[model samples]
Target: TTCWFAPGSGSSRGQGPPQQFNQVQTTYFTSIEILSDLYKKKVLIDDYLVDAYIDTGSKVNIISYEAAQNVTSSMEPSNVIMRGFGGLHAQSLGKVAFKLFIDDLHINSCAEITTKSNLGSIDLIIGQPTINHPDISLVTTSKSVTLLKNNISDNFLTEMQLSSTDFISKVTLFLSDDVELSPGAQCEVDVYTDHELDTSHVIVTQPKIFSLGNVSYFIPQAVLTKTPYRLQVVNLGVHSINWSANKLIIRAEVFACRYVLSVNI
Candidate 1:
């Protein structure tokens, strides 16, 4: 809320006054309906509508410490740390199982609990973990977004040629059932690409460790071109999984799913 530029702290030094820059702290939020996912049925979380902030820059989903307390489950002790853009880690109350409906969709996962009052009036902060929904689209020009299922023919299409930076393929892993991440627990995998898509050289990303829930999807995001593209996901987890169908399907913070990468043909 403060907008004034101060000269470099020590102009006396030869560094001279650094370029003046405006520092602005802003927040983006959206309205959403909240519900609890349960056995064969769903219930509203607070018997009221909830407004959630859509933050594309965040890696993990966050629920205010106070909000998490309102849920029916008990908070499990977790060592997961929340880190901001500057790498400053924030303290958390702990992690809790959260099942809720937002934007007319269902979300069942464990959300880290934060008691910080800085989230403004919103109880939930939708982060990147959910924002990558395959069907979601954000139009800043109109301040609007699109989500969920839609026909590719329903919209304009642009064929994408192979590019070094374009991810031709994607990979994911899922626990058979809801499993909690243990302290110091992590997963990793190596990604490989082939010529089935017709690229001369194989583009392989380094072994990436998984860190989706907290400060970590440490998994290496392998890049690639084809449907169910020819690739291999070497499972590194003895007890966990390694490869999954990589699609643009992600949960959105439009108030977000999985890591979704799309190629237009």
Candidate 2:
């Protein structure tokens, strides 16, 4: 019953997967373009190797039902339901405690048995709860991945409660020169923090309009309150295009409103 969506992105809604043995959960998810590498890690589920995807957007870890069959742990009923592409809903089979290895990193995690019939060629989708272990810090850049066993930071020493998610707005994309995309051109979209670091991917299917829905961001109140300063801003008021590594790059700086990005050719 397990299936993979558009690489990185999954829908945030659910229709509901039903209960009963051999019954499939019709979890719906949309295609989300994600940055991927061969960083596939393997672990045994009843002796079968499950290559896991380290998906950050996923709030929970999911393992295919077949994988669960190989493990010895009993399933703990899960109330979690998921939404897939085209908005199909699927229910989870429950959860089981499992252990795996990411290189030398010993990962002990609980994985939900999903109704996803299969994960294509791979087997597991590792989500946040499994990767958010307090003792370790994981950082993956364009070239390298660094995992810290223990570290502390005072930048965010205090947790700020968010009042709402209205900081960002959704927008579409278009060429400044108005060039049409060739049939189905594949592209990846990454959203960075204000500093252009700490990247996250949003799935953009339609080439002409890479729409990121109302994605709001939160900034610590203290940083803005005590040390008020203007940050060096890029993409503020520029409509330009360039070629980078054979891929067409469109750059636009937009104000906080819904408008089509005019990437100049």
Candidate 3:
């Protein structure tokens, strides 16, 4: 997702374009489950089990006040600032470290975050640091996710072996010599792979293009609303190849359309 935030009043605003400001982009992972083993007891919370959003944008895993209290009874009262669609809000804080399990992969000593009930039914927001494992791929779709782990690595080769099932899809990788774009606009490059697959494991090496014919793709929105930008496609599956250049911008506009119509009505 790409987000455009208006610049605050400052001399820094003069450093860039006048109308647009900074652009924040994040690769979102969702429909994930986090299982915890407190002592000898196991606790499983699926994305459906407890409201959760896998946010690469967040740096730490945040658990709701009610959920945090339920998990750890020794939470202390503290103040923290939480940012969201409605802007910044003050939230109470606490800490806890629990074993986290995403899909079949498990990690111990994961960071725990605490927040107020204002985050709604979400039990927690899983951040990047906890889920940024090297062996696994976090595929984000319009509604779901598929976690793919490469068992051929030295760490997992002993525990498991690579199989045909690991090839979830035949992805065609592409690299642009120089990515061109309009100022304050974003673009999306679509590459058609060999088969329709569910996992997001398209790896790009140096000179990342399979074939040059009709391989160069473009979309018409500025990803960062600024002149210079870098694009990295991670954890992409074949079925979800049609990447959006300004997903956040589109989402925001769509969300506000109803409100604008209501006001006009």
Candidate 4:
């Protein structure tokens, strides 16, 4: 058989520049069943650790109205309309931007906020924007998903296969240098964490009973900026006090967002 094909023809046999295919963005709205249980993972939304549904099939992220309110009161107007599995449609109230921490991956993500009824029991939905992030490399199977960054994977396994404590663990701060506090004096001491944190600001709380005893010192609750968090220690005792280097001082919860320092003076 003899065949003739045009170079610019929009056909499989065409040799010219192939027809450019414009990609259309797709939005997926989850059904009650899928949103409740499928691909559920614990992700840090702003500072709250909540169960977030991971929907790789969708392109846009979503958060329940109640969840968005808890994360942030500020919401920008959004005109996105989402379609569910069974042709059900929902209108997004607005969009909120927040920091999301998925294991070792940190994403400054924005999500459309819809009514709670639209999400059923789910609070957040992590969609392709997160899974296909430029900084992340994801591998998935029928029952599991793994997230990798820079070719290194550290327990970024499926939710069922990994424990929440593995990633949401507290960070311990240690005194960075030897410090001596004089009577009725206060000093701002620098503390170091074992590893870098995802968020720049954190809330540091003194343990119920710190290693320091009979020191009459007070470490106020404060929001500390990272890369060597500074803590204020007030020595109320009548004598001098010394804290050696690398001494455990206070601990900060991972991704803690709220902290207050009150002073009467």
Best by lDDT: 4
lDDT of 1 by residue, 75-168 (tens): 7654444444132334445566766665455556556666545444566766555656555443232334433333442453444454542443
Candidate 1 vs candidate 2: the TM-score winner is 2
Cα lDDT tens digits, model 4, 9-112, are: 11122111123332332234444347334378788888887778777666678887777876754777554556662545555566889888886777889998
**Candidate 2 C-alpha lDDT tens digits along 73-141:** 777766555555234555566778876666455667787666445355456777767667886666666
lDDT (CA) per prediction: 0.41, 0.45, 0.38, 0.66
Clashing pairs in 3: 175-208, 185-221, 185-222, 186-221, 186-222, 186-223
* Model 2, runs deviating above 4 Å: 1-34, 44-48, 116-118, 146-148, 151-265
Q: What does the lDDT read for residue 40 in candidate 3?
A: 17
lDDT of 2 at 189: 30
TM-score of 1: 0.36
Instruction: Write candidate 3's Cα lDDT for 134-202 as tens digits.
Output: 766665455556454755334444777665536432233333233333423344433332333323322
Of the two candidates 2 and 3, the one with more favorable TM-score, higher being better, is 2
In terms of TM-score, which candidate is strongest? 4
